[model samples]
Structures are given as C-alpha cells and as structure tokens.
Target chain A: MPHLTLEYTANLGLDADAALLALNHALAGSGLFEEADIKSRAVPLHSFRSGTAATPRAFAHARLALMPGRDAASKRHLADALLAALSAQVSSPGLETQLCVELQEIEADCYAKEYRHG
Target chain B: MPHLTLEYTANLGLDADAALLALNHALAGSGLFEEADIKSRAVPLHSFRSGTAATPRAFAHARLALMPGRDAASKRHLADALLAALSAQVSSPGLETQLCVELQEIEADCYAKEYRHG
Candidate 1:
C-alpha cells in the first residue's frame, strides 16, 4: 500500500481535493501501485513560514510512504512523478512556491496495516 | 527536524487542530526533538473506506518522518508516544476506529530541507 500526503501552505488558495486527485492519478498512472490501494490526502497549513522573512513564499511538501524494497532509482522516479503532478495541479500562479517530494520506506517488520475496505 | 502528520477519516468528527497540537506537544515532550523543530499537521479524509464495507469504521494514521539514525527501540518509543497522543486527542466516541503510527526515517543522503522560519 502506498500513502501519499500533500501539505501546502493555506495562503496559496489551492484546492486540496483537486490536488489529491491529481497526485493519486499520477501515482496510479505510474503503474507503481494498484488504483484501489493508493491512498492520498491533502492538508492545508494556515500558519507556515517558508524561505526568508524578506520574501513571503509558499511551499507544498509531499511525503510518499510505501513498503521498503523499492530500488533507489524507482523511488526517485516516484518522487519526480509526484513532484511534477504537484507542480502542475497545486502550485499557484504569481506566488514564489517551493515544492518538495520525499519518499520514505516503511519498515515491514515495524509496520502494521489492516485494510478492511474489501 | 521531525514532521508528524495525522490522517483521519472525516466521519469521525474530530478536531484536526487539537490533534495536531497534542501530537506536537507529545513529540516535544519526549525530549527527542526540539520544540521548534517538531512540525505536525492533520488531514481529515472526506472519502475513505476502512475494513469491511459491512461495518462503517474509521482510521487514523500517523507517519513520523525524521533524519535517519535513531535506534529501533527509540523509534518504537516514539511511535508508542505518538499513538497514545493520537488516541487521546483524536479518537471519536462510539466509532470503531483503528489507530496506527509508523516511523519512517528519511535517508540523509536523499533528503533535503530548507527552513526559513527563523
């Protein structure tokens, strides 16, 4: 199972639902996960400071959590894909925005998931 | 720096802001992270399916991301602490809910952060 979370500064005036759908579609389109198994959500940050105080900037950070085993190259590809989707769907025009995507491997031994959405 | 994110089902009718604060405080109180370095946010899922469709249930998942290097035991402690905080602050009454906490270490070589909130 892959869970992708996008957190964006609230001031950007982006639609969280649309962003989530875009990223979820991107992940599913990558053929990296089953469409049904992909879980994506977005959070808006009302109070966040990014870059230097001299310039008011915005940021969107995505964290992809998946089971450990993927090769580094594949993970990098996933991050890049997610980043592209975020930039296209979530980034606001006329705003200095920094976008980040991080891939984190969840250790199987320590991780536990019980899905009952059958 | 550590970033903790809580993703909960929207049907639970929980307060996302309170949960974020509780989790942030828990992480800071653990003394494992500086108060200023702990960033926590919550996302409420409006559309989600958990377990069997026969029973409508909810789930709250927390992913803790930190720089790689903490030992297994320490990470377990952190997870337990986080789970406790989430259960205390976010779980709704009269709903069958599942709570999960996962610690994912960010590979230092691949991770990058640029904070300007000074």
Candidate 2:
C-alpha cells in the first residue's frame, strides 16, 4: 500500500546523476521496500515554467514503489528524507529558496504494464 | 489515506466544465472525504503532443485528496469510479483508447500549505 511519487523543482546546476544517487541512497535499507520494486524517472523540464519566478529549470519527478506494510509515519519519514536529500544539493537553504516536494501513494494495480506482464 | 489522481488524454470535443462536473458528481457522497478538502485543477494542454498520434488535444490531470481513514479497497473503488466517470465522457471506449488513472496515498502532512497554517 506504499507507492510514492515526488514532484519537485531543482536548480539547473544540480547534476541529475548525483541527485538520483542521493535519492537512492536515502531510500536504501529502509526495510520498507523490495529490491526491484522502486521505479523512477527524471524529466528535464525547460518549457513549462510555473514556479520559481519563471526560471529555466528541471522538475524531477521520482516514483518509489515500496512493499505494502508501511504506515503513514513511515511513509512521511521516507518522503521527508527524500526531500531533505534532494534539497541538500543546493548551496544555500531557505524556506523561500528551496525545491518543492509533493509525495503521493501508488496502488498495486496502478501500473498497467507491470500488471499485464507479471 | 486516499488521494486519487487521473491523468489522461481526452478528445478535443470534450468540454472541461462537463468533465469537472462529472468528477465532482462521482465523489460527491463517497463518505470517505471531507467536503472542503477535495482540490482539483483542470489543465487544457494543447502543446505537449506525445500521445494519440500527435493530435491537438488536452490532457486533464485531476488530484483528489480524501480523508486519512479510507483503506485500499475503498480507495480503489473511488479511483475506479472516478475513471469510469471520466471515460464515460467519451462516446466510444476501447482497451487501446482511454485516459490513464494513477492513484496515490497521501500522508496527513503531505500538503505543505495546509500543514503550515493548520
């Protein structure tokens, strides 16, 4: 019952690989996820500029599918940890000048491709 | 713990108001939601033409945040109901042609704006 999707705006300077690695590290060994269940995708957004005063940046949306036993507390912990890891990439941190994080839960039958094949 | 999001490509003929009303009607008396907590935004996408053979159509992505008491079964029912309502707008439906439905879990403190104020 735990599937997390994160939508956030990160600075242009942050390396995608580094950010992804950091996300993986934060999610690793949480005892709440299976080995291959975690799925993620990086979208380099340069066109639709809604937030951050129309700056040309990328919004990386990551989706993590975990095992179905975590409660709200554990989900919040993982989501917060993921955001903290992501925002740490910035040289300076402030409430007004940090990346945004929105997390969501995913259902087991939500993935059509996975469900149809396996 | 019910947060449902539906992202799908509808034909150019579908009216936004009708679609939104259909959504609202489906979730009106679900008994799983707090009235004012349901938030939605209808984006008429015309530029991003990735699916449907590059047709100039809109992709409506709706987000529904419900109370923290509904379980997976209830959540799935709500999500399926929402999609059925959405897809019903189309005159014809087929397996190869339909909008997408993605459901996620929402923690109590996931909404930053809501959490900071109340």
The residue pairs found clashing in candidate 1 are A116-B51, A117-B51
TM-score of chain B of 1: 0.90
Q: Candidate 1 residues B1-118, lDDT tens each?
A: 6888788888776788888888898888888888988888877786554321235566788888788777787777778788787777754566556677887777789866787965
For each model in turn, which proportion of the native inter-chain contacts is also found?
0.08, 0.07
Number of the top-ranking candidate, with TM-score as the measure: 1
* Per-residue lDDT of model 1, residues A13-39, tens digit only: 677767777788778777877665566
Give DockQ for candidates 1 onward, in order: 0.14, 0.07
Return the lDDT, model 1, position A78. Answer: 85
What tens digits encode model 2's per-residue C-alpha lDDT throughout B1-118? Answer: 2344444333434666677767767776676665555555555432222221222223333446554656777767776777777766644222223254555555767555533455
